[model samples]
Target: MSEGSSSLPLVAIVGPTGSGKSELALQLAERFGGEAVNADSMQFYRGMDIGTAKLPEAERRGIPHHLMDFLGVREDTTVAAFQHMARTAIADIRSRGRLPILVGGSGLYNRAAIDVLEFPGTDPAVRAALEHELELRGLPVLMARLQDVDPVSAERIGDAKRVVRALEVFELTGRPFSSFMPERQYVVPTIQIGLNGDRAELHGRLAARVHGMVDAGLMDEVASLIPEGLREGRTARKALGYEQFLRVLDGESTVARASEETIVATRQFARRQITWFRADPRVQWLDWSQAGLGGAAEALVANSGVAGA
Candidate 1:
């Protein structure tokens, strides 16, 4: 938790799933000497390319990207762990006198990298009781309690595993989970650039993107990962495209059906991402379709009040 050098500004490109944040980051990095640090949780897993929409090496345009394609599918990654690693990467990039361009749609991941948010440690004794409560009073009761205490987090989190963990953090920290998420206070000097455009247009783009992923061998990707214990990993098993294709492998659906489901799931995820980023007032939104978008962003970063960019 050492203070990051303020001489180098941290630039983050964030927005909905199909908002072209990744491409924009690449453009900005090329324009302003910077290295991209992956904040997309799914892209961290190796061999998860087609489904995660991970850019290939040739497409990276020779720019350095860190925290990407390193972990095995069966390995689990925690937010605290990712925060530590991302901060380390950012520090390293800054020390080398280059700007760190953090790119991803994962709200918590991006926040962990640049914001002053802290992750509470688990209390096994408290966690066990919450799990027992989840088993006894059912998810609704636990969710209601969390809603009463941390509605922001309750609204943000959907799956039971996360809900239970949120409640645990509340109990262990003796504070509302939402209270931990104060307004946009940067842990490092930063410029948060958000990319977005027409909703219907984005929906169409996401649908087409999903179909393209399937054509790029997503089904084969899932089938190949089954032996890698992808199904055994709590987080990896639930990734948008991978989860749907996993259903196809389980004989519960067809490739066409799975493809459609993946599109819908990705679209919904995009909506949630939009909501999450919209809550942060500090974000400077840029139209993804703007002409000379890269040049505009580069100018903004280079001329901004932050001492160094």
Candidate 2:
């Protein structure tokens, strides 16, 4: 909130899954004397390391990372909560005379951190009625209704819960949920570095990453968390690999099948992420395989018009 308090630009590293965003964030933070603030929604949960591809502490290379591993599996965080927390982290990092480098593929969460967006209030009664309608009329019916009332939101939202929420917002506020979507306006001095590469190469990397997670004991990790009420967790249970692996644990699916499903799901997720970030003209995209990528990013920061780099 203090515009003149810090001299460093708020840096964000964004890209699809398996595009080296995390490593790039670390390199830039180290170069600019910054701390890493997580915008990845899944990485917020504790004990979700393998599936989320969270960097182990040693791999963090002594850079202090914020807003990670802070939530119980069963806890749910709204975008509003994340926005407040992320802004607070950025302000704190700047107060300490350090740059704040945000890193994640969760597009909305990334925007919430640096964009001038405000969430609308929720009404329990309105939400309850929508939920009741969803149960009675089903998702497709509600989704169709949303298409009529707020076609932009309907096109973007797919899941049952979000569809219901969108309808609720429309009913309560007489405004489309898409009206609240973040504009390309920054709340602070910021620079976004987006990583991308050949689509086929990215697919191969993602598949290999999923297989690597399986080999790294993703099943065992899920097994360990089951006793911790992983199944009861609303959002955590739905994570890509965890969801499939949970089926395997229930004897409803085989690990190989789950792995394959996870690969497919992860690839789809990456595509969505790509679409989300690519639409933002403010982002400066760099290839993941660019030579001297770290140095190139540093040069961007240096020329970003921030007081200090």
**Top of the candidates by lDDT:** 2
Candidate 2 — which pairs collide?
A: none
Q: Count clashing residue pairs per candidate.
A: 0, 0
Give the lDDT of residue 123 in candidate 2. Answer: 89
Model 2 stretches with alpha carbons more than 4 Å out: 1-5, 128-138, 306-309
Error of 1 at 280 (Å): 0.9
CA RMSD (A), model 2: 2.3
lDDT per residue for candidate 1 within 12-111, as digits (tens), equals 9999988888888888777767789999999999888889999898999989999998798899778889999999999898887777999999989899
lDDT of candidate model 1 versus the reference = 0.86
Backbone clash pairs in model 1 (N, Cα, C under 3 Å; residues 3+ apart or in different chains), count: 0
TM-score of each: 0.92, 0.94
Q: Which ten residues in a row have the lowest lDDT in candidate 1?
A: 1-10
Local accuracy by lDDT, each model = 0.86, 0.89
TM-score of 1: 0.92
